[model samples]
Target: MVLDAYASSNPDQVHEDVLQKSRDACYKARDAFYSCLEKESGKKPTEIASVGLLYPKECSLSRTEFVKSCRSSWGPETRGGILEKPYTFSSSSSKFVLLISDVSGGDLFMLEFMHMMTKLRPFVHSFLKEASKMFVLYIYTMGDRPYSRQMAKLLDPKGEYFGERIISRDDGTVRHQKSLDVVLGQEKAVLILDDTENAWPSHKDNLIVIERYHFFASSCKQFDHRFQSLSLLKSDESEPDGALATVLKVLKQTHSLFFEDGGEDLSGRDVRSLLKQVRKEILKGCKVVFSRVFPTKSQAEDHPLWRVAEGLGATCATEVDESVTHVVAVDVGTEKVRWAIREKKFVVHRGWIDAASYLWKKQPEENFGLEQLKKQGTDEKSDDVNI
Candidate 1:
């Protein structure tokens, strides 16, 4: 409210100063208001920030115009309407492609359909800065119009990244699923980053599946997860070496390949195929075989590890052959492990494949060796005995 007032008072400079200047002004206003309330109610200022409802009497008198204007502008009827439209950068010559998602970029937690708290994924701002350079960035989220606009304000306050290309739940097609049919660009050029794969079932080829970011307890609870939230743990995903970082590198490569390598014909290029090819090269030139990795009754090709290995561009086989490069096993005593050792092939735990899948890079074989697995098993057994 204070920041809004400051923006209204300095309409000419608000665009450039809202982030820093208005932030400072809001903090000062909050402090003064809370101090005044605390003196009247005999409560701590810290508690006032959280759940205090007392309005500062001085602010009511001093900021009467601002409050009156705000009330008139944001009355019950006007509040639900669209705040802003999608913006287009006239200087950008690149082919405009839309990015649609619900969870990949950020997650919003709602309390009783009234208050909302948003937690942006790590490196999101950096990702947007980089992505905006390559594609005409558009945000299509399932959140409501007001909430989406609020998130956009935090993400691209200067309005340089995502002009008016924001689409909210109110703009969605029937069944509440995101559809590229409404997007102005060609379907082949659009690339979507979303955590829920099924949400874009029709556009799976264009969709890049990302791991969901769960920061708050409410977010985890919404997904029916019982694990501790990142907020409660006081830790977040690594900013430098995190999911968004990896995704940005992929986007850069895709954009470069799309514009530079794909020749002058921009319409013929598709980022989805480029992304698939890039992912395939992560574990290329390797043959992986699993021993005792899956249950005896389970189909070798149907196993999760097999799918992960194949997805990473590694050929998965049931038997250790001369072409095999790595033997993934749980126990070092397995016959395939001995065979791999005899053939001088890399014998590693299943975690090596899993790590490569998650990191999108070939993990060091030394870090996932049978010795490490043996030590882990020993430690587990010792702990069990102690129990």
Candidate 2:
């Protein structure tokens, strides 16, 4: 009330021309960025502008301007991901603004969320068919409403997949990050498949990180990766072994474990607990050998990565043998790496194992190939160091 009276007493302070103009510019930038979000709800989020600010690849240009124009006084409300002030979007259909009449009653929220991945990913129908058997599927994303609904049609032309269970940015009650509260299912039974990990900080345990598909060159440059995208290179993950397939395997396992007893009483099962075992099986039954990855003075078994590989259910061996399925190394000329390459086994960089650990799923070995070198390996004994 004091501030209101002060503003009335001092109209000059409240009507400052420069401050009002700056705020107008900020609001315009915010609206444009958000409009882009509304239009490209089908795209996966790849461009991470900051710690919690991740948006679809198509919103890159507008996001930069939004940040640049609004870096001044906008507070991070953790709701709309805005930086300056209370972000208010009035729907053209109903201008009924949600001015909180009661804060203690857990005030209603008009959370800005969009069901991203609005389109059916490659092989999505099959995955959904299998997933629908064990889990209720929901398409929760950071996208606009009209585009989101349009993409939903593209993803589910016959309305068989998500039905009316689509959750868009406009459907959310929280801001900045996405939450499972928007979902009707309990947190224990819900599993999320998203590429951006931090977008849902409150529910990392339920998240299953999926490999991003950058089908365009413009998408690759936004992430600033040193290498070109698979699409630009005239290749992509094989359909049978791509992320959708890999995650399908994980989901099926989770389903099996959740109902392993066959008693049908699901009150005792928690997917979060079963995920640990499922993740361990990512590299199961594989024997791995490492070379030139650890210091000469350190024990190979004592290295951190050795533990990571072991934790992923891969048996670590120092020697190249018939049993070794993978050779993890930094240098392509290493004895073990060369042996694995010659024997048609997987020769992968340390990042391959690290990726598996971080992603909770085995990454493609092709993406983690060791950097090729010009020198030929010095002649060593036959690959069969021991049986």
Candidate 3:
């Protein structure tokens, strides 16, 4: 929907005049509203933004009425199976959900993937409304090409609703932990999507590490799978479309458990049994991880359920130790953040140079203002340097 303020800031060159005409109507409404208001109200009625024009043209959102327009096609009344029912939101205490994945095959499928997500925006909204925490990450192993650029569009459409929830980067050493550390700072939900088959050196082993982190956090969820398409089927393709469809259905439908339910009450035995069943369902295929993040020391000490988590084949770690190697802190507000590596007893206070570069990659502006500083640091000799 177009608001009566700042709509002219962006207009398609092809339809500039048409959009301007529509915006003119909004301007008139804003003028009328301002005309009736008293100056003492301390508000100016200016032409606001057109939410419809904010979407990419290829998304077919020009005729969009409201943000809700995208979601009007969801729920049981529309079509599909039981999972097809409109999502029933549970109040989320989380501020974000982090989705980290190493998507294979470059960026070809990203647009279509985001289109499908935008289609599901309504359901996402339903989940967010009840969620206390909010944030979702779609991190790719492949670096700064189509994935990073397109993810920015999907996460922050129309240049609003920005937060710590959506972060993407390619630094192998710090990508997983750094992103998770930042997301957990606000105790938000996390959804890690690993589509790249060999994302890490020991991906299967890394999955174990990730599972431990999630289980300990008490505020994380994950979804990982290999990328495949059913539409690729040509006549006599002999690709077993039904089997592929069944697996996709199970992945999409059952993956909701990652977003909705916390899966908290399951004990080690229960988790093992459930895993066994899930394994049986896929004939020993598919790997799933469920975890919880505990934020406070007292919480961990009082409820050592995380200790039990390791028994279920998940690693459980507490990030409280000052001497706990592997802690990397990146804070935009801090002059210098702390960094610690494994077996390192000392915490190094690195200047914001590298950290700032990292942030710039994630938060690029019209003009990057830190180039001179990076050049200076590149010449300096320091162990703290990590740019």
Best by TM-score: 1
Q: For model 3, how does the per-residue alpha-carbon lDDT over 146-204 read when each residue is reduced to its tens digit?
A: 44545544434443333322334532335433333322211112333343323444323
Candidate 2 regions with alpha-carbon error over 4 angstroms: 1-120, 284-311, 314-347, 354-369, 372-387
Clashes of each: 6, 16, 43
Per-residue C-alpha lDDT of model 1 across residues 1-387, encoded as one tens digit per residue? 987687568676666665787889878976775564444334454442232121212333322243244444432222111113232222125544748465344433222133334556777888788777677677778877765665666567698877656777766664668777555455556678777777776887787777677776667789965456776676778878887787777777776776665344454556778878887898899999877777666688997678878877998888767999998876666688888889999988877886676567899999999788676553111111100
Superposed Cα deviation of residue 116, candidate 3 (Å): 22
Model 2: how far is 358 from its true place, Å? 8.6
RMSD of each: 15.6, 16.5, 21.3
User: So what's the TM-score on candidate 1?
Assistant: 0.63
Please, what are the lDDT tens digits per residue for candidate 2 over residues 193-251? Answer: 87776778898778776756664454568765445655457555555766677777877
How well does model 3 score by local distance difference test?
0.29
- For candidate 1, the per-residue lDDT at 350 reads 79
Q: Give the CA lDDT, 0 to 100, for residue 76 in model 3.
A: 31
Evaluated at residue 132, the lDDT of candidate 3 is: 20
Model 1 ranges with Cα > 4 A deviation: 1-92, 98-100, 103-116, 174-176, 217-229, 261-263, 293-298, 302-305, 330-334, 337-351, 366-387
